[model samples]
Target: MIATLVIGLREGLEATLIVGIIAAFLRRNRAPLTPMWTGVGVAVALSIAVGFGLQLVEQALPQAEQEGMETVIGAVAVAFVTGMVVWMRTHARTLSRDLQASASAALGRGTAWALAGMAFLAVLKEGFETAVFLLATFQASTDTGTAALGAVIGIAVAVLIGYGIYTGGVRLDLGRFFTVTGVFLVFVAGGLVLTALRHAHEAGWLVIGQQRTVDLGWLAPNGSVRGALVTGVLGIPADPRVVEVLGWVLYVVPVLAVALWPRAWRPSPERVPRVRAVLAAALAATAVVLAVAVPSGGGADLPRTVAVTGDARSVTASVDGDAAVLRVSGRGREDQITLPASVHRRVARAGTGADQWQVTEDVPATDRPTSLTLDQLVGLFGRVPVGVSPSTNPGPFAADWTVRDTVTLTTVRSGVLEATRSERNVLTLRGGGLPAARTTTLDRDVWTVPPADADRAATDLAAAQTRAAELRLWNAWLPLALLVAAAAQAALAARDRRRVRTPTTTTPGTDPSRGPPADVPARSLDHAVR
Candidate 1:
């Protein structure tokens, strides 16, 4: 709620400021305000409609697709907020002057309608950004009701403030106000960076750096007020991944520095060296820590056996480090299929839950034609099993399922099978009975398999981890670089302030050694200086 409120107040004030400036300018010229008001009204309606449309579109998508859409929205929101923050930081002081100038130009040209257009465009820009940002915040928040109420209150306050200022009933320090709010917005935007990356991973667009960086459960426990503030308002997940934390830091450090740095300050020669040294040292230290922390990755436990049972038969898959065995049994019949070491490694790399492999076999004439189709695989269970029947013609089957601790059938086709463990899984069948998709049970059971090569599996997993770590490590360099730059900027500002405070010994004369000219009296010289 606080996040949305700040967003609303800041954005609403900016819009109101613009509209008020234009309205006052028109009134001074004795022009009618009807066109300007009409434009503002239309823009407001469009913004509201756009927000609702985006929400509807999100609701219409499948879970994974919805995640993808959310990733896009979050990304766009981050961009919008960043741009708004930066632009406002630099432009807030000059906004009224610039708008008045433009309004005057329109009036001089007798194009009063251009003023209306300007009002429309300015309000629309702010409105569009507000809609997107609030949407992202609402999605991230645990309590939408409070978030909405806060936003409404914020906008109302902004409107009142804008009106008060326009009517000459209120005075404000616009520059100071914007500077304070700009810093807060930077924090909000940094949180958005984390949100976007999380959505990307869930959308399956990003898979690297999946390692847990730290356990933050204690910091953000479920169903607690502190948790809501930390996770919901601050946008930190209970357990953040390497990439998400990296993203947050990378965005926050430099952007916050920019927000806090004074606009008029310039770099001082004396401060640059110290700032550079600090920055360089930080970068080197970060590199050393990352190098030493690269995971060795050989100590993973054996993956749990996934036993999937349908109406007619039950299939159990046990995967050791290097090999996988699938056991199928029902109706007094048993069959076993073992994946080769290479196939097993590939499947393991795909992800946990073995849901994404398509295996094809080239059978010799004598080999039982191991190329099993969907129908043949189903036959391994039983005849005319309950809820499952052979279909003469199979239509395209594409559905997504979400269940806890449940085995999901991902795909079925000729000579190919793919399945995976995930919160959201897709099912695509070419020939299986529709009813067979009704119910499936996933049980955790132990199955003994032949001893396999542990070293090879460990090596594979380690290499993958190392690669992901390398990517994250490189990505981290950018933030460190920006941090150094911000530090230097800050050091320069401090130096300037100290210079201002330190008394100057030099006189106003170009030559401090030369007193007032011989012909000039001391009293006259002092008055001239003053």
Candidate 2:
């Protein structure tokens, strides 16, 4: 609810401001308001339709595709909002003048369609942004109806504020309003970045740096109120992966620094264009480097063999890209099976000919081989022969066997585990070599074969590589494009500022028919609305 409300208020107010400026300009010019209002109505309806249509389409997609779509939409929303924030920050002071100038040009054309187009385009810009933003918000939220209600309320409040301004009953400091909202929106955009990264990961497009950085699930488990608030409004998960944390930090730090930086510390108008051009070029270059440098697959290679040794027996597994093989051997008996990592289990004969028997088990998928330790493998498949005295009939005997083993296995990454297993095994011996009336010791050993650990590192790496490729386009390059665009806008704004500051030469007896001199400062259209 809070998430949707914030989005509603931020986007709704922007739209309201645009409408107020257009309406005030039309009224001041004595132009008919009907066409402009009609245009606004049509744009609003279209924006709503687009928003709902997107929602319906998302609902119809498979879970993986839905996650991918959500990621794309969230990323686009963040970019849009970031652009809007920066553009508004730089141009809010002159917004009224710009709107009035556009209005004058439209009115000069002497066509209602011109006025309508101006209003339509202005309102449509804000409306479309609102729709996309709301869509992203809804996807993040658990309750769509509540999110929609919050948005409706926000729009209502904005409309009331707009009406009050138009009636001269309210005065809002546009600069301060935008600055404050811009700061808030920066955080919101940061959340969108985190959200997009998560969705991309879920969609199997991103795979690197997946280790959990922190686990706060004990405090705010998923589906809990606390979790919802944190995840929905802030996009911080209870358990966040390394990439999510890194992405959030990278996005929020620089964005907030730029958005909240003091105007006094900003570059002088004379230096603005130079600075903007330099920044733009640097960003473009960096973008190119990133595009070229990021690898196409998981940065690590899969190991050829993963082996685990026990007290008397050992198991070794190998994967050759597509197929997997597991070999278990002990007590002069060797078992080999051709296993595909895709399946959960495989059954094969462990011994040759008369000594052969069917063994059924599988290797569990793991990030590294060490997770399948030698002790675990020994506990699962180790067998040793024991010679007993003649008095000890070996038809069926149950004995407790304790085995201690140290296991070290390394794959693309490394992990280690040491374990001891104590178990009671029932054994049936068909024949035994023992001496009668001779002092002989009884030997006991247990034999069993359990599932081997499947090396899923390759599969996971492949998935990660695919995700990284996708992110290079959506997350990395898209943001760079937006930065370049913002830089260009800043450069143009600086040029405009320089032009405005230049003094215009005027003769003492200028013709009155020419109206006010071009040097005359335009009255604030917002003030006219109030």
Candidate 3:
């Protein structure tokens, strides 16, 4: 919720600021703001369309492909956002002036409508950016509602900022604002970079066989402060692939190089001392290095099986870590606590005893450091309901799942609970029967009722559900940040045009007004884009 709100609020404000600036500009110039509204509408509609399109793409994708898409978006977002941040910083004054001038020239078209159009288009540009950002984020966040709410708040704040700007009450040191936000963005981008890599790994796009990154579950989000921080920052899965780690490093390296290069450049005594440069570099290095130092193999989207005990005919128990789990609840008479297939057979086809009985206990083995498909992972809660498989919706259950150690229950006179233990088993439900045998790894929903502590099973399941919710929640909000960024870009552009057309005291191509900016010659905005 917080992530959604933050991204939404920030991005929303940006859009509102753009709208306000153009509206104010038109009002001052005695022009209709209709074109501005049209432009805004178009931009917003386009952004929405983009978001929906991306969502469709995400939904249509298989588990691995969905992950691959996520990875690509994160990488793209990091690149675009980081580049824009650096650009804004270097060209703040020049860009501002350019924006002012463009507004003036556009207004001169004598068509208040024309100037409004320019304003609208400017806002639209930002809108598209937001669209891309939101599309990426929507796929990553665990909740969309929170993200939507946050965006609304962001827009509201932006409106106020725009109003202040018009009334000459807003005096933001934009450079500083960008700097602080940029820093925050760096972490966010890093998270995305890490996340995308995880997706790519799942998709089989890149492979680094048999090496764990580092299991920092102690500090990792395996349920810790740092873990949450990392997750919130960029959908960063605690267990990352080599390629993912490499991607993160590559992306962040460039950002740091760009953001801190100037600060760290040793300057003469006459120049201002570079405290910020030193501090930024240290922070950047520390954050990355520490992340690297943390141990790998912390958490996985799927549960890591700890142990299981069952034989060919009937399997009785399972142990998830320290928790002792009971797999079969309907154990006939006698509390031997034994799952005897032979005895179950006695019950099976016996006179008037409901239906035949057959039991199988199949416990899966753990495989690591490899890419997994939807077939491999479950949303926690162990597997499906006892007897149910993951492939089918509420996949069929072999027998009554909730029975205690010994509870009387009816069975299908036909089927058998055939259990098989293997390192990687792929299960299939062929033609009719109970569970048509197929092969695969992983298990159906986990057996939640532990013979010892049923509550533990419930807790573990609940935690799994929570994690699933969180992953989706973060994904939903991630997009808002990008969208908000887009809006911010529009506002900055508008502001820049205003300054640009503001009739500077100097001539074109020559800065007599600011004394030619010392040794730097004035460059056109068009040139800057390249």
Candidate with more favorable, higher TM-score: 1 or 2:
2
Relative to the unseen true structure, what is the C-alpha lDDT of residue 405 in candidate 3, on a scale of 0 to 100? 24
lDDT by residue for model 3 (140-257), tens: 6656765666556765676676556545566555455556666666666677666666666678774432146876555555556576566654567656655456556756776866
| lDDT (Cα atoms) of all candidates against the true structure | 0.65, 0.63, 0.49
The superposed Cα distance between candidate 2 and the true structure at residue 413, in angstroms, equals 16
Q: What's the candidate order when arranged by decreasing TM-score?
A: 2, 1, 3
**TM-score of model 2 (CA atoms):** 0.60
lDDT of 2 by residue, 9-29 (tens): 767777777777777777766
The 10-residue segment with the lowest total lDDT in model 2: 348-357
Q: Highest lDDT, which number? A: 1
Candidate 1 lands at a TM-score of 0.59
Which residue segments of model 2 deviate by more than 4 Å?
A: 217-229, 273-530
Q: Estimate each model's TM-score.
A: 0.59, 0.60, 0.49
